[model samples]
Target: MTIWMRCFTGLQEVQKEQSDKLQDMKQFLAFIKKEFVHVIRDRRTLLILFGMPIMQILIFGFALSNEIKNSKIIIVDKADDVASRELISKIDASKYFEVSNERISESEIEPAFQKGKLKIVMVIPAQFNLDLHHSGVSQIQLIADASDPNTANLLVNYVSAIVKDYQSEISVPGIIPYRILPETRMLYNPQLKSAHNFVPGVMALVLMLVCVMMTAITIVREKETGTMEVLLVSPLRPWLVMVAKAVPYLVLSWVNVTTILILSVTVLNLPFNGSLLLLFAESTLFIITCLTLGIFISIMTNSQQVAMLISLMGMLLPTLLFSGFMFPLENMPEVLQWISNIIPARWYYVIVKDIMIKGLGFASLYKETLALVVITLFFFIISIKTFKQRLA
Candidate 1:
């Protein structure tokens, strides 16, 4: 009887243990379902989780490109002979230049450049064929807008190669070798210093990320911690409160700009050719633009993660792609190029390059400056309006 009773107690304990294990599993599954429901309910979270990857893949595959093609070129056919026409035909046939039909004089080239019509201008000297056939040598002058040094170099190289190919085709085996000497002149950036290009781009990227990302994150963090309500309910006006939040970041961004300039000048040996006052003034304007953009973003989103993701995916990608820094804007599709105009960094990049690299004053930068002002005001107004709406 005692043995049978002990066996019954052991069996009961084993069944109890099994029931406890089963209960734990049910609780775990229920917790998992609760988490899934929570995630599904947050639409922004879902979008970030799924939409971000698709957006990144599409942008990387389509928008980001380095190859330069279909550059506009102008040719002055001073020697309108058969040989000159043949050379022009070859240049026009190449995939690089989209030759203009409008015949422009050599004197009109500078004005055409000022109007940003063409990338390269080729001046074919008079008696080009006569010089080539009789003396076995002729000179072709290639004037490239070296504002973008990399593209200018590549364009010059492409033209030089075309000229060489033409010379080889016309050469007779037994006779004097025909040679077309290409005299290349790089305008704006004579030295072709890489720093001249990279410095302005870095300025745009750094200022943009610092001012936009930091300001957005700071304000969104306040909202996340519920301190934003406290500040809003305080005696201060909401716009003033938001401005107060931006002030520290604005000052910090200014210091950052100053530091970037100092380092660029001292370390990179880049010339500070433009007026320091003008550069600083423009930098302040850009900083204000970025800060206002951040404020707008913060008002739109409640989560720090979403704000950060938006800033990185939205701001960083566009700045890198559209600012004409990592890739040539001319190489992108027309739609992408059109989209680039709305990006504040694009104008700032141009402004910095003009002032810092090209040594231009406010006279040369008024258009870009005006663009920044308009963008700043747009963001500033919208941010204020959104903040008021959200608070109400």
Candidate 2:
């Protein structure tokens, strides 16, 4: 062939190859579209696929932490002397304990403890200063309510550290030898049960995340795949559609919640001191709230992958970090604690812990319950508004 003929042949080959690649691209796009539609058609499978994994992650993260701090502490200064006052100052100065109140007698401790107003009571005996002056070694007793073992142990350690720091600063060769001894006394969970501290928080975080994140992605998958379009084009209103979508997962979540409780109480040997009916009621509300949130997410996002990724990043991370799941809220910076307030999971976690472990009733939990209700309502409103706009 001539040189021109050869160049012409090579150009034709390049054109044909480009055409083939374009055809291949079109086919791949069509395949992806078909798969997306098929997956979206069935809600149950979509929910299970996304929901189960997210639930497991939240549960694992929530259960992994046991740190406690910033517990409310009360001081009963019967001593009313210089040394006792100095010790009280030390307690106040410490980071872990927040001095909520002062009491004059041992009788006042129970009422404050019952009210959940105080976690630790420091008793500075009347002769505390005199003893320090005369005997060189003086003891201050730390009485902690062990109802929450983690808090109790934490309180004792905090008080000891404070007193020790005080002792170190004042210890001089010429000064009066004064040893501030910490006699740590605990009232409730003497051994500081790990199960009691972790179980309630775990149940709340895991169940809520699973129910909400799964339900949201499932709905989004249906929408992206064109199945949701067919459903919407039908006579069924959006509200009824949403309700129907939630019912199955609601039942499944309830079963999962029950299993979690049984395992926590029986296998983990955790205490279930609160009302079972109340716990169930709260759990149900939390699930509903989360499911509503999922629905909202679905209405906003277009693809199941985007929905799933958003939920994992937005919901799971905050639930783990701000819900006091992985880190104690007290240990977090003040800004983070404020940030925790916005997370629905945080309130639910506190509610579950108070109800299941602390045996607190509605009166005590009204604030947390109200907070979740408000958040659920907010998500519902935003989702409804967005969905309606999209439909129009």
Candidate 3:
């Protein structure tokens, strides 16, 4: 009887332990379900977790490209002979060069460059065919705008290679009778220093991020923390409140621009050839444009997280892709090229390059300056409407 009682006690203890273990497992699963429900209910969280990755992959895959295509090139057929015509035909046939119909003369090249139209100008010297056939040597001049050094280098190389192929095809096998020499000239950046390209792009990226992201976050933080309503109820007008929010960021962004300029000149060995006054004025305009954009973003989004994500995903990608530093805008699809037109950073990048790298005057930059002004006014008007609505 005693042995049987002990066995029964042992069985009961095991059963009790098993019951406790099952209860714990159920609790764990219940907690997991509760957390899962919370995640699903928060749409923004779900979007960040799932939607952001998809968007990033798509953007990175499409926008992060370096293949050059359909770059505009002009051929000045000075020779107007069979060899020159044949060379022009070959260049036009290439997938890389889109032979422009702009009717460029040798004297008109500088003006065309100032207008930012032509990438390369190929000048076939007079009597190219006579020299090639009789003396076995002819020269082709390739003038490239080297403001964007990488593009200029690639273009020169492409033209040189094409000329070589043509020369080889027309040559006798053993005697090598035909020879064509490509004379390469880089216009703006003679040494082809990369700093000339990157400095301006970095300025655009830094200013856009600092002005837009910080301004949006500061305003959104007030709303998120429930202090914005308190301030709006105070003596200050709504527009004043918005202006007050934007002022500090504008000043700070200017400081950033100054710092970048100084560093570019001193550390990076970049030339500050344009007027300081002009550069400062342009920088201020660009900063205000970015600030207005940020305020507009703040007015649109309720939470700081959404504002941040939108600012980063929206502004950063466009800046990197359309600013024409990381990749050639010409290489991208036509739709993306059109989209680049709207990105404020693209204009700013061009302006900075003209001023700092090319030493161009306001005449060269007035169009870009006008673009920034238009963008600023656009965002400012919309932000005011939205802010007034919120106040009402």
Candidate 4:
């Protein structure tokens, strides 16, 4: 309390006696303009700044897809009967698995799975068709690369689905009387487009880059070049100096949000089921949150490089991981899920996905919005205190 009081006194008493309204305003604008020029004039950084989004869009939009196609698989069939051949044909037609090779010897299974980059190695027993016809069930062995456990599970599931479909098609009358027919309906994202997930996550990353990285870098730049001291010593209040520093970035970060929204809708066919105004407003809050975070980091570090390292390591990984942007929170261990609650981007992602995909209103998003607000206020207040402490 005393620290803040003394800071306020210095800011008020020192600036008030020497304050000139017109000149101060002019100096603020000039400061902002200089920031703009710094961004525009740096050819390498300018290219990277704009190029990053374009590259991200192109890579995530066109190249990445959730639907797995033509997974490599090897089959070891002891029974090369008509039923076995038909099952193999059905699996091939499903487009999810491609039979790269087949072998009768069980010895070939391990080698094929290891060298062939096979997703699954399936072995059909001798008299598999005869056993299915007489006994109503045929046993098979499936070996999969469990290194990527999720993909391995998916591959097995795909194969299971294909086998079931084939089984239903060839079932004799009265042979499969007891059956539980299951129907699935996917809402919001019926097709389960990868973009439906990636866009929001990428947007979170982009917002982080724009606000946190940029603010931290710029603030540290001024500090490194000794201009931060100059600004603090000037007639302008120190808080006002920081505000001027953030203004240009706030404007540019908004531009980033708008541009991304437009591209997402126009090019990638992004679903905007809720109010655009709400989305932008929430994004604004998140950006401010990141900006405040940047200010906090700047106060702790002396150099731009240090700030960059801190931002990348501290916020970026946590945002990507803890935000459910990559791995799901529900699927994570309970302790990890609890820890994810503190990452600001987790709340932002829920807000973005709700508005963009689920079409939920502010009524559903109040908690998430409140969380972001709380985090932002926490960081903002701390950064302000730090700034005042440094100025004093």
The most accurate candidate by lDDT is 4
lDDT value for candidate 2? 0.75
lDDT of 1 at 324: 93
- Most accurate candidate by TM-score: 4
Backbone clashes under 3 angstroms, per model? 0, 1, 0, 0
lDDT of 3 at 111: 83
TM-score of each: 0.57, 0.58, 0.57, 0.86
lDDT of 3 by residue, 210-277 (tens): 67887788788879999888877765456666666666556656666776676667765677888888
Put the candidates in TM-score order, highest first.
Answer: 4, 2, 1, 3
* Candidate achieving higher lDDT, 1 or 3: 1
What digit string (tens of lDDT, one per residue) describes model 1 on residues 195-232? 67767887788778767887788778879999888877
lDDT of 2 by residue, 244-353 (tens): 66666676677777877776666666678889999889888888888888888888888888888888888878887888855789998899999999888898888888
How well does candidate 2 score on lDDT at residue 173? Answer: 54
Error of 1 at 286 (Å): 0.5
Residue runs of model 1 more than 4 Å from their true location after superposition: 1-180
Instruction: Name every residue pair that clashes in candidate 1.
Output: none
lDDT of 1 at 286: 93
Q: Output the lDDT of residue 70, model 2.
A: 61
Error of 3 at 225 (Å): 1.6
Clashes of 1: 0
* lDDT: the better of candidates 1 and 2: 1
